[model samples]
Target chain A: MFEAEVLSGGFSNPAQDSARAFRACLDAMARPGRIQQIAGAVPPAPLSPAAGAILLTLADATTPIFIAKSHDTEAVRRWIAFHCSAPVVAASDADFAIGTWDALQPVSQFAIGTAEYPDRSATLIVECEDISAPTATLSGPGIETTQTAYLPNLDAFVANSAQFPLGFDCYFTAGNQLSALPRSTKVEAL
Target chain B: MTDQAYNFAYLDEATKRMIRRALLKGLAIPGYQVPFASREMPMPYGWGTGGVQVTAACLTPEDTLKVIDQGADDTTNAVSIRKFFERTAQVQTSETTAEATVIQTRHRIPEVALTEGQILVYQVPIPEPLRFLEPRESETRRMHALEEYGLMHVKLYEDIARHGAIATSYAYPVKVEGRYVMDPSPIPKFDNPKLGGNAAIQLFGAGREQRIYALPPYTDVVSLDFEDHPFDPSKADHACDLCGSEVSYLDEVITDDKGSRIFVCSDTSYCTTRQDEGHTGRLSPEGEAA
Candidate 1:
């Protein structure tokens, strides 16, 4: 249902907010392991500001999204429907997915895209309690040298990097803070 | 007059977001072409519609833009693109390479080294380096997935066998971060070395192909070649007649009916900058007068 309260959390100024949010997302992704602050959307419960802003900026009618069970509240659903018009779908079919690292577990379920069209892969928006852990060293494209970040799991990312051009990218969100780990990044324990 | 009907930068917010998302993915997986929903622009496909679309998505009112074709600012295609953005995006335009925050280019990297915080959007006619060697997209995709670049090696080997050297010149192939083999647009092989360890972010867009890819700052971009053969970044071997610069790429110009020729710097800004610094070549206007 497109209730007023649920939609109120959407961007107040869609054009400018989305542009700014997308830039922040671009900056974070361009410089892997670097964290950026994003603001614009005030999503319903369980979604942090970074996650909300990303959803608003990237999701649309054409993009099917998957919301993990922990954050798949009725209000969140309504909010997404009213604001982004994105269809909620299974993880395998989603262009984007959102949830805690544990809730969105078995990352293998999400589409990593085919070799011919790897860009079709899903981008997972992971909610974290804190992103300042400095748990792993990240090295690869976007990183000048090695950079460190608080990733949820290093082994999973190492495996993902092994997949190379066929892995889903991830964005970790903690409140307004955001960071990304593209499949290209090489992850190692700190 | 600019068309006011279109949204800022000529693309709707949703489309820009979609493009931005693809660009990020492209950056993450350096040299891997990420498929995107390419839009129809006012210009033709080969004329840099792809680069134009990418530029439109990345631009803001605060940004200073530059567009070049064959490294010349006055080239017809470059002029048209610069005009399009000036009218539609209402952004400042610059012929000075160093002054631009975002540069959309076709077929050449600037002679002036790009710095941090700048973005280079390349207009690519073909995004796949394997497209020519293996005509089938399906087959090339498999080869890439399997890390089977043997066919490419063979192709280069064949060139070496026939020509006693690698003959392929423009649009030379590069391996990104030692992973995916990428086409660095149609820039001369001379520009290939500049692709690696650059301070600026380089993004490639192929509108007709509907793909986008990127090379982030300081990423490894090795030109594809065998150890025995070795990749050579060769140019015209002539100094620019206008700037007297031997290190820059030179464009050959026919000056007379008798078939006399002169070489000028392909990069106009670089030539002008050198001239401003009192550097003059044999064919310079002042030099000719003297």
Candidate 2:
């Protein structure tokens, strides 16, 4: 059993909040490395505000989500179940995953989608300590010139970029700040 | 119509979320079409149900929307879509391209350069650039996966072989970010260059085909062309007879029974704006200054 407090604090206005949260997520994803602020949901511990808001906005009954061990608390699970109504599943079978960079290790295990339908790939919501680290150089679509960000690592993302149209996309969140790193982005250590 | 009956924008929240997810994924992978479970809008598929759905998902109460067909806001289809949004979303509508936050377009991009906050949603009949050469979906999927664009190159080469120049004029294919080959809808090749490095976000929806793709703000989009025979974006070398705009795309209109014709700017708003600024052309009223 979980505390009632953990399950109760979802978006006050589901429709409007979700819409606003989604637009924030969309903006961040479209312009990779650009940070955007998002709010609405205050999920349980270990789940950042941005991550929780994203989960509430994007995850639903249809999407199977995988919660990493660091964030796999009863409170987090209860919050997710109550708000998103999404079934928690294994990373391999998940359409979305939530955790920190370390907890989501072996990212290769997640679905990168198939040739016929690359949209089947997984989207990960990674909780980070800071989004403004400014440690890597990013360039590609959405970027007119190279931009910098504080990525968890360079090698893994570069490897992921090499996969091209067949790699999982990622969102990095810290508190209410969010930024995305789509597979299309070219990441290099600064 | 009572607001209680249907959800905002006429789409259920679940459907919007689904489309939103697909849209995010599409933006993540520029120019690559992401398959979506398109819903049955009140309109038919070919008549921009896809663009409608995409617009519905993106619209907020504060957004000012513009709908256009062949770059004209007064066209039948454009009027219909504008009315649909005004009725359902209860949002302000604009005929001027500069004022719109979200512009849903069929066939052509607006002549005015888009700024940072605007979003362009395209109504696409066919989203696959390789559909003509290879009919099989499975084969085309593999081709996209393997980056096998030999067929497209050969087709362009054959066009040059047949006609001294590349013959494709509309629905010109572009490679986005040097990865996926994307179909920039049926916009004339003249607009293909506009697809790249634009400040506004570009979204493409193909309802009948159940596909959605995107080009994020400032994305790199290069038209497919050979080195020697570079892609040439050429339009009829004629200025609008009414607006006198030389750079805008012109539509040929028959003026008389004796085969007399005049060219007018396809972008009605751009033409009207120019005219309001006191610009007159050969076809303007006799009293107006040239």
lDDT of 2 by residue, B144-179 (tens): 988899999999999999998999999989999888
Q: Over 4 Å off in model 2, which ranges?
A: A1-3, B286-290
Candidate 1 per-residue lDDT over residues B1-290, each given as its tens digit: 77789787888887897898889888877888888899989887799988988898888777899999999999899999999988887889999999999999999999989997789999999998889888898888788777788888888999999999999999998888887888999999999999998988899999999989999888999999988888999999788888799999988999899999999999998999999998888788785621
Task: Go through the candidates in order and give each one's DockQ.
Answer: 0.61, 0.73
Model 2 agreement with the true structure over A1-190: per-residue lDDT tens digits: 3567676768887766787788888889878898999998888788998999999888999999999998999889888988889999999999999999999999998999886677889999999999987999999888878989879988989998898788999999999999999988999888
Model 1 earns a TM-score of 0.94
Q: Residues A1-190, candidate 1, lDDT per residue (tens digit)?
A: 3476685888887766776787678778878878898998888777787898999988899899999998999988888888889999999999999999999999999999887677778999999999987999998887788999989988899999998878999999999999998898999999
- lDDT at A160 for candidate 1? 95
Report lDDT (CA) for all predictions.
0.88, 0.90
Q: What lDDT is reached at residue A171 by model 2?
A: 97
